[model samples]
Target: MPQAFPIFPLLSYDSRKNSMTEARNWADKKTLGGRGHFDLQSSPASLVLDSVRAGDEGLYRCRVDFKKSPTRNARTNLTVIIPPHAPTILTKEEGQPVWTMVGPYNEGESLTLTCQVDGGKPTPRVVWLMNGEVVDEKSETQGPQRVTNTLTLEKLTRSHLHAALVCQASNNNHSTPVQTIINIEMNCEFYVGFSCLKDNKRGMDKF
Candidate 1:
């Protein structure tokens, strides 16, 4: 009868630093000098990260030393993907109001809306959708932590009334995108015998 040896009895891992190896077991979470975020997989010789972060992205090396065979080295890279915060829609001039319904303006009035998102590893892209159709898609990076996109409608028409406007923010395909919505409300007009009539619904007559 023959005895079988285990696969890669002892495996060591390290992150690439300055193009050199620092001689550390990065996959040993319980080790004194280990990063504590990684766990070594014995059977398949893999490294598992418990919770990934932006700083943990880089090239990694695994060294497998066999008692009767030549030592083998393999390298792999890790990339971290961070999801962005929920999108916010700002309409008011002074305060940021998360309005579910905005308007009651004249049909010919213009409109402007701003969408903002914060804290994504690769920066989030913002887009505007009206009634399930893409109206605008543009994003600006304010800094390393914030991104913004603005939508402007030159004139609001009767077709915009009760229309759903959505602002979507996304950074990666793995996670669901964050979004916010607002419904447009236009002035109510009644026509009787070719004469236009306005009703005082929200305190103002004729929008």
Candidate 2:
């Protein structure tokens, strides 16, 4: 006579909740159904994720317990790929778009431009471009998924006038980049010498 094998109970570990749920009940409210986008299958016992999102990333463990026998378990990390959000470009001084004409900017003055992205999984890389030329600089992580990149112009010059400045944010998961562009403009004074001459003439007349 052939011996009968005892059936084992299947379980799944929810790393986000730090709890274990029966395989058949893996989609219960306390497990993944509350958040949706997840499902469990029997026969070979598999987990299915639909329309995955960044918040759904984490380590998932599967276990089986047999009566009068040792337990078996396996774990796999799930990473959801998401593209970065559109980047925002602004002047460091006013926190507004560099194209906004608030006031005149003098030549030879240092200016800072910042590019930021609100969210992305695994963070995103920001790159600055001047007239389509890449500006080699480092970017800082503001939060878990927020990132900022800064570019400094040591001296504003006539050549920078009408120049296009662009910021692009990207990640390995997506080839398309989120970007923003701004055109530069300089102060209106055409000749400093002419202004100085007018000032000197006023001083002579007062004497």
Candidate 3:
């Protein structure tokens, strides 16, 4: 009778694991030939790794054994990586954002606030938010380090006074996220409208 090769237990790394130190096992328990499994069968001698992440960098071995047989094995390692998304604002930057009237904008002229974040790997994604909700606009990224995210609110009525604006810079690769916020004044004075009304009233009674 031909003697069967043995199974050997080894270590492996799975980036998706809940804990970094946690190890996983993957090997074909039964082999076609008691002698050993050649590279022919992808199952018994092969493993397919998906979404390989940075944490997956480590060593692994294949453990094999047969009834009343000695143990034999092989070794393989894997590495998984995920790329960066974009950069966004975490909190109010250095300067206090300024707002002003434009083109006789009595209703607190629509102003623009641009935020920039520096440094990230594989670049990052830029997004703008209002009171924790994402603002609807075309988000764009530029340069190697700085990413610019802008928020444009058209015809901001008095309802949006003292609105909270936030900028979120995202790079899914990193464990901790980055973000920024701005307590923007989105309201205009009603006095401007009241003055206009007074002027129109004063000029009336001619026809």
Task: Give the number of the best model, judged by TM-score.
Answer: 1
Which sections of candidate 3 miss by over 4 Å? Answer: 1-108, 190-207
C-alpha RMSD by candidate, in order: 12.4, 12.1, 13.6
TM-score (all chains, Cα) for each model: 0.71, 0.57, 0.42
Clashing pairs in 2: none
1 against 2, candidate with superior TM-score = 1
Tens digits of per-residue lDDT for model 2 on 1-207? 533222432233344333335323434444444455334346564666556666667666666566567987777787786778888777788798654332245778876888888787657888989889998458899889789998888878778777777888887754788888887777744754423233575565321
lDDT of 1 by residue, 1-207 (tens): 533332442234444332224546533333322434334346664565545667667666666665568988777777898888888888745437667987777878888878888888788889999999999998899999999888888778888899999999888899898898999989956666654456767654451
The whole-model lDDT of each prediction reads 0.74, 0.68, 0.52
Q: In model 3, state the lDDT of residue 98.
A: 37
What TM-score does prediction 3 earn? 0.42
Give the Å shift of residue 22 in candidate 2: 22
Q: Which ten residues in a row have the lowest lDDT in candidate 2?
A: 2-11
Extract clashing residue pairs from model 1.
none
Give candidate 2 misplaced runs (Cα > 4 Å). Answer: 1-48, 61-74, 97-106, 188-207
Q: Is candidate 1 or candidate 3 better by TM-score?
A: 1
**Model 2, residue 103: what's the lDDT?**
29
